[model samples]
Target chain A: MITSAAPALSRVHDVTEEVFAAIREVRDATVAALAPERPLVADLAALRPLLWSRLTTGPLAALIAGIGFIAAPGLLADAPWYLEWWQQHPSGQPRQLLRDLDPASSAFYDYTHWEWFTGPRVGRERTICGPYVDYLCTDEYSLTLSVPVTVGGAFAGAAAADVFVRNFEAAVAPALRELPKPAFLINAEGRVVASNSARWLSGSVYRGGLAVTPVPGLDLSLVQGPAAE
Target chain B: MVSSGARLAVFSPVDSTARVEAVVRRLADAIVLGLLTDGEQLPSEAELAARLGVSTVTLREALMALRQRGLVETRRGRGGGSFVRVPPDSGLEGRLRGLTVAELRDVSDHYAAIAGAAARLAAGRSLPSDLAPLRRSLDEMAGCPSPRLDGRFHIEVAAASQSARLTQEEIRLQADIGPLLWLSRDTPEGQDEMAKQHQAIVEAIERGDGDQARLVAERHVLDATDHLIELRLRLQD
Candidate 1:
């Protein structure tokens, strides 16, 4: 037992020493890699532009641009028309959306919209449609639709609105199904007649337009409202 | 392209010295930007000397300057060479304060959501192999009984999620939040609550209850946030 313990103790010491030495080696190597004589900076500088060019001018760029052009109308369709119109409007107040909508609700809507828009959709053919009855406000309504409206630019818009709505519903179905709350139905008037879970939305006044609640602790003022026309 | 006399002048020690300084500056910038990470061995001194077309002495001098900056450390032995130092945790307070309240809240919220998801996932999906290390971490936490250990416990869970980006972001955030957490750890209640939460999180993960795991992990982060907030408010008072 004594003889066994002696070797074990020595082995433990040896292991400890090895570990410390390894740590020292790692530290020294890290320090040397940081030496002033190293050519990493020049190499990285040369590499950066190559990466940037590849990202900006290569297939990746074209792919992104193609996707954007294809998806822009539908993606932008749900965006508040007043905001969209306002951007083109010579005398539009950018703050009108904020004024018309509750700041928190609008912000929440914007956040959720951003989340929903950026999220994956189920189909390429599904058109993007919005201005669906705003769950927040029953009296208010807005809609935007993006279809492959043009063979070139305007031709894709030839798809009927109902088709776009179907695609939008299809695209949004998975997320809606995953939602912990039951699907709430709103009529064209924008009233939430029934919902599965009503804790957050119940008793909250939803004007006919979509009402968005601000994320907790986020300041609504910093958020940009839809463009003013 | 230079005249013989001009070329001679350019090759003089003064010009050579200036060239060395420029090279050194470029190298320093690279290290700062993490083009070179800690523990990566440098090229041999002779190789570097030849590449730069400078005398070995000049290269040595540039290396020495870097050594003084605490960026590089040297070892002398048969197989020994220079290596980079682990950057010390510096400017931690300024970094924490640099975060906007909104940004901090967003990060906290994101951490909460993701950590919750990870806990739930770990509980529901963790294999027999996964439980051992997690159990080991719990054992270590129980043994160490330190706030630093507690922080490491949470960070380990984030790392266990197996997302490199998430792990890196968690480390950065942990570094930023280090001082505040350190200060909070001095309080008995803070220490006890943190430990309890950590144990609960581990248990939740063990049980394979995702919702419970998520809730526990989220509550743990929020508890830390609440403690930090209270500490800040107290200091102001």
Candidate 2:
């Protein structure tokens, strides 16, 4: 990392922070909604309108495709595990997403087994887990940011937000382009998230010599300047 | 039926030229696969064009082709917009017959490469939960035989590889030749065999056996190609 690129790298870092902040807001709301007691299915449904408004109107709105809560098994009074998720339609209306939850059914979406849910529950920390094709909420290449929702220190569920990779590229790539040397962003797994140059494709592993600059609080690093490809 | 994720993939921005044809095929595949329901209204032209990242002129041309194919109905006045009009059994045999044997083989080769590599990578990279959609597609095939069943299964497998590029390629190949290849799945025995093959692939992935997963996926595609080639020969005779 070069000393002069510090400002440019921070600009790129700010964009990521904005995304995490938006996801944290959703997580905070979800904790408040389930704090007193386990909410019935209807009570969970009631929180949709408020969450939808916040998602659509908040910062980085265009990049966000959806946001919701995924309950831990046996956390819901009526259902074993539940998803209070909502996805944005092209027509600008938000629709509640439904998936088969029966363990016997082949279509059952066992969210508890996914990285976004498990990372938070196991690590008890906010996590960012993607740049891979979502194939669930939005089929576009995406990143999911999640936080564990705890009730009195017991695991309850996770609150997560889906961000489109294309939009993230559009928003953050400009800052990356400002640097004198080629630069890219990589998540904890070393997969490229966004790059200023075409050499670093999203979802591909970065095996080049790494720069030492880390992006603020994220598990991401801003690799600036050149290294052996 | 096409998964909602696949439907969203179909609507993502077109990156290649021949935009008109690309748009036409995507919407046609959506309709035929039941991703777009019969009698459902489509978005306004501007909104749709924006979503697909295409110019209005290109969208109009594609819509014209769709209307000509009888896959869409354009009404005037109140609630006036294009609506999906799914044709009953859209000439599957005729479409299959249209392909030259050479063309069919070429497509099968390309599909096998993508599907095989996807299955292999998925076996190495995917979490156990990622196998749900593959099993779901197999269950759907066993319960009710349909052409879209196997195509969706392959797409789900590609998705599990966690590679967006491979997933996109799988979706494109499915749009191009999926219906023709899956035609044999309309038969009960064919459905059972197809389900078995898909199940083998799923089990291999669950067990994290990349070599086994790739072999099974490639063999399944080869067998389906042979079946389609035989059908083509019979039709020609």
Candidate 3:
């Protein structure tokens, strides 16, 4: 699989690397903001201007729908769970997303259990969380690329960015189309992120074990296969 | 225009095989729902095709179907393109009258399955804020039979379920036959009945009762199906 699909896999690798690089900037800034002292909840406010600025002017601006820091449980002095997330509105202004962190609330956003948080906490260098419908954020099918935020060798939280699958498809579909065979990008869970052929729809899990070339350094694979009938 | 949910369906990309039929159905449903109003000019074929991810040839086929159905008209030359022409009866009654009992039952059954499952999952998965959109839809339903709000209400439930596949299915179903299914909302009594049922489903979800939410959601769909069947019978009579 690697030998036959190396070029296509490289394209997928390049695009995924571009996305991770952007997310790492947020993660690096987060780690820096928390490094000097035992973190105060107010300290995260420094990330606000940075997030807003980057989301608006960054190279991945159009691809990323939201960007921010998601703190580890009890990492901040006053807040046990917090997400300093901001999503771009259709009007071009970005808005901060507020979710119930209270465990008692039925609407509580228990993001800690999500892959984006859990993967990094468990020591994965980077993670791609979903092709799931992000009802909580953009309400589009989204992929959350995240990196672990660490301070002094201790886990803190994750800095993540959201990319709507449609925009993602637009970005990489041309690349996938360049391949000689049907190809798709899948998260580690075998869920299809995007596909050049309609036979593999986004959000559908691909069960076939075909020629798979894993995108280096990310929990994603570029699989080449025949379209299912 | 349609609500956010239906708008997603309206502009969503379509695959090659289903391109013509999908485009026709989406535009037809939009017209029936009054999302596209009478005499309103549609975007050019090229633009519409691009947004829909289909070729201009396929879009022309869809436009021809809409013209045949009396839902759109095309004029050539300057200031000439396709324009919406909502049918006199708003196309709902006639379309309903056109259905056979079995077809109506099949579609209604399929909808109930989807709505029931979505409601059940939402009961377990939805955050408190997710209820806001559903509540707003109910509040809007109080005034009139706004199919847009009603369609949005169901789609929002699917969204609450946190499954994009379910959400997409709900949106497609709404665009396909939602106006017909929700035709009962046209009457004041029907409007109140629909709103109450929708509210019941929400309350069950709030209570975190998946079975109860599923029950209410399914019954709501089945009851609407019955009303549709009854109306269809009357049209036959």
DockQ of each: 0.01, 0.12, 0.08
- In candidate 1, how many Å is residue A103 off? 52
lDDT of 3 at B153: 79
Give the CA lDDT, 0 to 100, for residue B22 in model 2: 72
Q: How would you order the candidates by DockQ, starting with the best? A: 2, 3, 1
Candidate 3, residues B143-187, lDDT tens digits: the string is 644666677678889877767778878877877688787866577
Off by over 4 Å in 2: A1-3, A35-38, A225-229, B1-153, B160-219, B227-237
Worst 10 residues of 1 chain B by lDDT: B1-10
Could you give the DockQ of candidate 3? Answer: 0.08
Candidate 2 per-residue lDDT over residues A1-229, each given as its tens digit: 5446667667767877776677677777777778557577666755665556644564666777888888888887877757888777664556566544543322225566567888889955768878767765566789888888888888888888888888888888777777654688888767778887777766655666757467777788877655434
Please tell me which predicted candidate would have the highest lDDT against the true structure: 3
**Which one wins on DockQ?**
2
Off by over 4 Å in 3: A1-4, A226-229, B1-237
Question: TM-score of each candidate?
Answer: 0.32, 0.61, 0.54
> Is model 2 an incorrect, acceptable, medium or high docking prediction?
incorrect
| Model 1 stretches astray by more than 4 angstroms | A1-229, B1-100, B146-148, B159-168, B234-237
